[model samples]
Target: MPNIVTLAEAKLFIRVLDDDEDTTIETMIAAATDAVCDVAQAWDGTGEPPARLKLAILSRVAIMFDTRNSLEPGIGEDRLLLPLRTVEL
Candidate 1:
């Protein structure tokens, strides 16, 4: 599956300018989306990805891009934390 977030959306989130790094950005988007989906168990019940998941994916992608040449990318724990919604039965 392709990334939940679009290339344009990822670019906007990371404030990217030209398309020079588009391939790298696209790769990051796919990886980030996969990570978020895995952590969030996002496909359990969904139409489109929720806003929070999209934000998490975007943030992760930005982190990966910014730290491409450095040490391992460190996405914050908060980004992977899902909100706990209680069910009223």
Candidate 2:
């Protein structure tokens, strides 16, 4: 499956310059994309989602990558995406 945010984009966002964590980052990207899309109710998956959705996914990936092993909760993009969410009825 094609990702809205590419691996290169995510690595740059997370300041990961090396390929040592490509697998890990890729996993996070996929997970973040899914979580963001589900939250935004923007799972059309036809092609690149909206820009807002992409931003949300990128933010999510950054947060997850930065807070990988932290005990405290990290910030989220939920509020930013709440306005775009749709009722699932």
lDDT winner among the candidates? 2
Candidate 2 RMSD computed on C-alpha atoms after optimal superposition onto the true structure: 2.6
Alpha carbon lDDT of each predicted model? 0.72, 0.76
Q: Which candidate should be chosen as best, given TM-score against the real structure? A: 2
Over 1-89, each residue of candidate 1 has an lDDT whose tens digit, in order, gives 54579999999999998999999998898887776666676355456667777787788887888877643434563544455222346
Q: Can you list the residue pairs that collide in candidate 2?
A: none
Candidate 1: what lDDT? 0.72
Cα lDDT of model 2 by residue, 1-89, tens digit: 35789999999888889999999889988888777766776456786577777788788788788888742323656666777688877
Cα lDDT of candidate 2 equals 0.76
Tell me the deviation in Å of residue 61 in model 1. 0.7
Off by over 4 Å in 1: 69-80, 84-89
